[model samples]
Target: MTNKKDENKLIAERRSKLDLMREGGNAYPNDFRRDSLSGQLHQTFDAYKDETLREEHIRVAVSGRMMVKRLMGKASFIKLQDQSGQIQVRVERDSLPEGIYQRFKKWDVGDIVAAQGELFRTQTGELTILADEIRLLTKSLRPLPEKWHGLSDQEMRYRQRYVDLIINESSRNVFQKRSQIVTYMRSFLEAADFLEVETPMLQTTPGGANARPFKSHHNALDMELYLRIAPELNLKRLIVGGFDRVYEINRNFRNEGVSTQHNPEFTMMEAYRTYAEYTDWMDMTETMLHGMVDALNGSTLVSYQGEEFDFGKKFMRMTVEEAIEAYNPEFDMARIRDREYLADYCVKIGVNVQDNYGAGKLQIEIFDATGEAELREPTFITQYPTEVSPLSRKNDDDPFTADRFEFFVAGREIANGFSELNDPEDQASRFRAQVENAKAGDDEAMSYDHDYIRALEYGMPPTAGIGIGIDRLVMLLTNSASIRDVLLFPHMRPESFD
Candidate 1:
């Protein structure tokens, strides 16, 4: 690591260079235009021999940041990296205008430059650009981190992401793959005839998910608003308004703790389809994810970290109680639904049992503590408890459980889906129950949204809804271990420069 003193010295040296450029009247030039990218040039001309390239005289212009410099007395080899990739430029003093090569020699690494030249192959058979002209485009004020060592501090990497992206190719590739994953998701949903829409980011009432919301006050209205925790309720309102299939890829805000699996501000894809049951969503999720794995990995298997999840085969579906029993057989299955028994078991197993927790909530708490992480394969844990899933429809035969499933892989939840509770009376009753839970000091309980209840009163068709965490999915696909690794600019504590 470079000490602060040494880093400041380097920045001062670069600043002096900038001062000289400023004296010459053009410290920053922006009119340089390039006709070719490094990757594209290599792709089109790599097959040609040195003699063939020189004979063909394929002229091109490229612009990128200078990454590597090898200066010999009168000639030099410098590598310029563009968005696509890197290319080598050969700068010869004899071939350029008088004094130009001397000026070029002073230009530092990390400086953005534009070069126009004909392509050739080096003696070592590497492709090169025999430049006729080169111009400095932007002067980088601070020197980049050393190339070989790169950015080693994880916290520093996240804090200074711009430098991380410039120095670390792997980091760049992760974000690139993130883009591909989101693009593939959008295309996949669009192909299914789902209409993409936008909902309010700032809401008067935060409905949808059970999470503490980040509050904001609307000064004009003199009313308090909230950054939406999820777009579920608004999307459902569109469903009630007769949109058969709708989806929103949105950012949700929650006043929550951060972890490798959680970000307070995160991206999610929420979709609702009318006349579709939760079971239909299960099928669609399987198909969509299976195809996605094949599209991204060219195989049905995703190797995340050390574990491999198979998407080709049918995703395993297990009930919450069954999973708990499978992972913790010491607990009595017969007493799984008994609130007192489950609460006692929870306390025994180190879960902080709350007094107001119902039987369904107790069962879920037990499952979360024991079973959630053990699900290594692509598995759908179904039949969530009604006490924990206020937005889900109650099962027909079992009133205590809701028609919901949380998709998990490699021990983390990536998606959640459930049948919509279309009955206005049932939804209203559930809202009242949630309000009561809030009154009992459950900070993560949902608020009773009368407008959403009114929307349901107008009669919505049987709908299925799902929210897929785009960040977590990207982490799985890109093999990134932390949620911050996938985010471009993750929230961080303010650092003191002094």
Candidate 2:
């Protein structure tokens, strides 16, 4: 979009400014230090009256980039912004050394500067810094975007995040809140005696989740590897190794299409606990979420994008069949269990269900088509079909369903967890089924990992594991509309300079 000619013209103008800056000793000086932030000044002095501030003579040294500037015949006003916030700076010909004010007049908006001044309120009641001395710390070569509507292009915003952070306070706040969310999650889990651990991102086999993997080759070893789609297997291996409880917050890679809810690479926090069941995990998850909401907002109720989600109340729990019945009473629960009936309904709803899919898998497709979008609040869809939940424990009373639960908020899955399938023989059988699924062109089906079966043979206790999409959680908590909005550098198609 930016043509070569216009780009060159701006470059030349900035270069001319750089020449003038070189005349000043050490144009990009780093030795300048600040005693306080702009936010600190406002916090400590915003309540003081103009006469009170002048009487107190609160001299403070601060440094930031020039965000706003208005020069008069002999005096000037500029807004200086730093990490914390922004404060106004007043400059007069008599305020600093005679030549310094003249030199400051030539400086541009994006230039970083250090100022030493006394705090006082302007006639309009703004907290201001009347500078006694000012110096440019770093000279910005390119001018900032236009004065008012700064960096509004969504694509440009993600591509150049530094500029986005500079112009948009809300954008910076989203990432800040994301950090808080992660911290709260980690702290809460640790408080409950869960150990945080690390797992390999690159693996010999992607056996954890049913997602397409990005494959790579290890040149040194002459072997193939995969960017792990999930850390489920490795984390469970830790469980077999005698660690009672563990959790990992890390990056996962999946060879998947880009969408509002998905990205190729994303963050997730997977946790496992020995001697725990799906019910135990569901309770812990709800308590942790409520604690997190309370910590961030002083309440457990959140308003996300105009929809009110009550995190304070207990979350709903229902079986997939129950949910389907609740959402669509017209569908016969008895007929839904029949393979042909479910398959026909799937086709009618435009959901592709292969013949390779068992009645359980077909039932899940029917549930997907009928019940998913009906969920508006926090709800746990439990009793997932065994065919689709390969690593989940099967119900003793009904082997057709696994003791699994997928947490949904605002109609999309945010977490998947279950009582882990620790029986070595059962796990092996499930892996073999997945292998057949893979052979049948289900690319997302997991590969067989004999090593995991061997680990299970050594005896893994009754363990529960859960994987929460950190990006999606951040999206919900921060009220971000898309996965891309939560992701600082979401993937995009290649761009051409021409």
Candidate 3:
């Protein structure tokens, strides 16, 4: 580890060079244009022989941060890193304009530089750029963290993400893959005729999910507002207004605890299709996921956290009760639907029992505690309790449960979908029940949005909606263990410089 004194000394030395550059009148220059990426150069030239490259005399301009610098008397080697990747640049004293080589020798490893050179192959068979011109673009004030040990401190990595991304290729790749994942999802949905729409991030009343919202006061209007926890309600309103198929990919905020799996602010893709049932959404989800896996990874199998999941196979599906029974064999299946039995079971399993809790809620609690984690494969746990799913339609044969399914992989919830509850009366009653729960001290309960109820009165067609957690999905696809790894700038505690 570099001690505070050593780090400060390095910084002072770099600052001295910056002071000299400032005296010369151009400490920062912005007019350098690059004609090639490091990766693209390697791709185009790696296959050719040294004689072929000399004959072709391919000239290109490249700019990136100097990652590696080997000062070897007359000739030196420095690797420049761009967005694509890094390429080796060979700088010779004889090849550069009179005093520039001296200045390049003083340049730090983290300095951004632009170089124009001819492509050539080194004696060792590696592609190289023999530069005739090199210009310092940006003077990096503080030296980057040691490249060998790299950025290993998790807190510091999240706090100083810019440094982390520069030093860690895996971190950069994860975010790149995250972008590709979102792009793939958007393209897939667009191909299916889903219209992308934006909804307000600030809401008058937060609904659509049972999560506490981050509150904000509108000073001009003298009214309270909230950062939306989910866009489910507004997206549904669009459905009622005649947009049969709608989707939104945006940020949602919640006043919640952070965990390996949870973030207070996160991204989600919520899509709704009118005249579609939960089952239809489930099938669409399967097709999309299967195709996504095949497209991104070139295979239907994914290895995550040492476990292999086969998207090639149909995702396992079972009712929530069945999942509970499958994971907890000792539970009496005959009394699974009994209210008193479920309450007792919940208490036996150390679940916090509430006065407003019903048999359906108890079953959900038990399942969450015992069954959720055991679902290591891609599985859809369906038939959620109506007590917990206020917006979902009640099952035709069983009014106690809703037509909902939560998709899980590696035991973490990834997506949730349900048949919409279009009946205004039923939805209103459920909203009242939620309000009562809030009054009874459930801070995560939903507030009744009367406007949504009014929208339902206008008669929305049978619709199905789903919200896919983009961060978690990225984690799964990119093999990132923490949600922080997938987020470029996840929320962190303020650092005390003192």
Candidate 3 matches the true fold with a TM-score of 0.98
Task: Report the C-alpha displacement of residue 345, candidate 1, in angstroms.
Answer: 0.9
Residue-by-residue lDDT tens digits, candidate 2, 40-121: 8888888999999999998989999899999997999999999899999999889888788888888889989889989988
Q: What is the TM-score of candidate 2?
A: 0.97
lDDT (10s digit) by residue, model 1, range 1-498: 344655687788898999999999887888888999999988988998999999988899999999999999999999999989999999999878899999999999999989989999999998999889999989998888899998888888998899999999999999988888888889988998999999999999898999999999999899999999999999999998888999999899989998887888999999999888888999999999898889989999888898787889999999998998999879899988888899899999999988899999998888888898988888999999999999999999998899999999988898999999999999999999999999999999998999999999999999999999999999998888999999988988777655
**Candidate 2 regions off by >4 Å?**
2-8
Q: For each candidate, what is the lDDT?
A: 0.92, 0.89, 0.93
Model 1 C-alpha lDDT versus the unseen true structure: 0.92
Q: How do the predictions measure up, each by TM-score?
A: 0.98, 0.97, 0.98
Positional deviation of 271 in candidate 3, in angstroms? 0.3
How far out, in Å, is residue 136 in model 2?
A: 0.8
Local accuracy of candidate 3 as per-residue lDDT tens digits, 1-498: 234545687789999999999998889988899999999998888999999999999999999999999999989999999999999999999999998999899999999999998999998998999999999999998888898998898987998899999999999999888998899999999999999999999999998899999999999999999999999999999999999999999999989999888888999999999988999999999999999989999999999989999998999999999998998888999998898888888888899899888888899999999999999999999999998999999999998899999999999999999999999999999999999999999999999899999999999999999999999999999988999899999888776653
Indicate the residue-level lDDT of 429 in model 2. Answer: 92
* Model 1 spans with C-alpha error above 4 angstroms: 1-7
Q: What C-alpha lDDT, on a 0 to 100 scale, does residue 367 get in candidate 2?
A: 80
User: Which of candidates 1 and 3 reaches a greater lDDT?
Assistant: 3
